[model samples]
Target: MKKVRIFLVLAITSLIAFTSCNQSKPVKTIENLKAGIIGETTASKKYEAFAQKAKEEGHDAIAMLFSAASNAEAVHAANHTKVLESLGEKMDDFTPEFEVKTTAENLQAAIEGESYEVATMYPQFLADAKAEKVQKAEQSFTWALDTEKKHNDFYSNALSALNAESESGLPTGYAVCPVCGNTYDMANVDDKCAFCMTDKSKFINFD
Candidate 1:
């Protein structure tokens, strides 16, 4: 009877952590979600400022891209906020910090930020959620991760064309996915967002 009781106790403890004995499990689901919110909020604000600077420099296409990316970052923040609330978690107060520079400098900063999120931050958050079996957190991170890749690419291309001052290959308008924060070319988007499958009709467009 003593041995059987000990085994039952072990089984109960197992339910609280890792499924396997040797593999370590993460336990920071809420922390990761909050970090995502803070990061996205800052990105949104920075992009908004960058958009204004681009417009001042007469780069309409770059300005439009920044505006779309700003909207997308807000969507990602909202998604993370929604998931956090559903889990009965409250975010701490946060203020966005950014510096606006010349269009070329601003584009470089945007590219670097997006690359970090796409390559490091979101991937770590998603891994944490997966290890902890947090489905909502996982979904939020996945959406942000996919969208950040697009933002990184867009910023890179914009920086490359900054020197050429060519709008020929640039998008005329920009659209953002409401659910996943994916940005798309307004002239060539499908009926639905490729990331979240949200209807394109629901997308917010900026020309």
Candidate 2:
């Protein structure tokens, strides 16, 4: 009887340890998701301010690009929030603080922000989600990471055009996938989003 009790106690202890190990991963993933939410939310608000600045400066085409990218960032924040909720975590309310500057300076700022996400923030979040086996979080991070890279390149090209005073403006239009925030130059849009496979027809177009 004593041996039986000992065996049962050992089994229960092992099960508890296994459950704890599993629980720790989800906690870590939830924290990563929350951080992603903050990053994306800040991007959304900053881009909106940047769009207004561009409009005020008469860079209408660049303003439209910023507007589309702002919407895409909001979509990314929503996706991250959804993942957090799925993990049984509540998302904290966030209000982003940003400075508004000249169109050229704002463009530079946007480029820097996107570069950080591509090179540092999202990469670390992606690794965390992957290690935790949180597929939804991983997907959200991947989508944001890829879109930020594109945003960086777009901002770079726009800055170049602005500096050169080129009559040939940036792309005629921008389209954003509502599902995954994958942005495309309207001139070269695919039938489906390269990242999320969302139908191009469903993309939110900024013209």
Candidate 3:
């Protein structure tokens, strides 16, 4: 009976140690998640403002595209929030700040923002999450990175069209995946997002 009690105590201590280790917060990963949330949230609001400016300029395609990107950013922010929540932390509420310009200028600005995120910000965040073994945070950063690539491409093309005064550069229909924020051209959209496999039915469609 004494031996049995000793063994049980040893097992309990091991369990407690394991639990404490597992519950330890990943500090860098948590900071990355919070920063990602702020960036995405600000991007969302910036796009919204840009969309309104596009509409005012009678640029339907630009307006629709900005709206789609705005929605995608919101989805990305929500995904980051979910990961943070899983870590038993909540983001402090903050307002987004951005300046709205002409459609051409806005497209250029959008391109720059997406380019930085795809090439620098998201890549670093994903790397940190992977290093910390924060699975959910890694997944969120991966999705944002992939989706930002699409946004970058779209914004680049739009800016080029604006520079050339080509109507062909303006897209009329777009869809953003609710699961991963992958952007799709509704012209020949697949049933599922290639990056995240989110169904078209679950996509947020815009025109």
Better of 1 and 2 by TM-score: 2
Model 1: runs farther than 4 Å from truth?
A: 1-27
Clashing pairs in 1: none
Clashing pairs in 2: none
**Per-residue alpha-carbon lDDT of candidate 1 for residues 1-207, written as tens digits (9 for 90 to 100):** 999999999988987555555453244888888888999999999999999999999999999999999999999999999988887778999799889999999999999998899889988898888888889889889989998898888888888888787767888898988888888888889898887788988989999
lDDT of 3 by residue, 91-117 (tens): 998988888878998898898899899
lDDT of every predicted structure (CA atoms) = 0.88, 0.89, 0.89
lDDT of 3: 0.89
After superposition, candidate 3 runs with Cα above 4 Å error: 1-23
| TM-score of every candidate relative to the true structure | 0.86, 0.90, 0.90
Query: For each candidate, how many residue pairs have backbone atoms clashing (under 3 Å)?
Result: 0, 0, 0
- Worst window of 10 by summed lDDT in candidate 1: 18-27
- Predicted structure 1: lDDT: 0.88
Ranking by TM-score: 3, 2, 1
After best superposition, candidate 2 residue 156: deviation in angstroms? Answer: 0.2
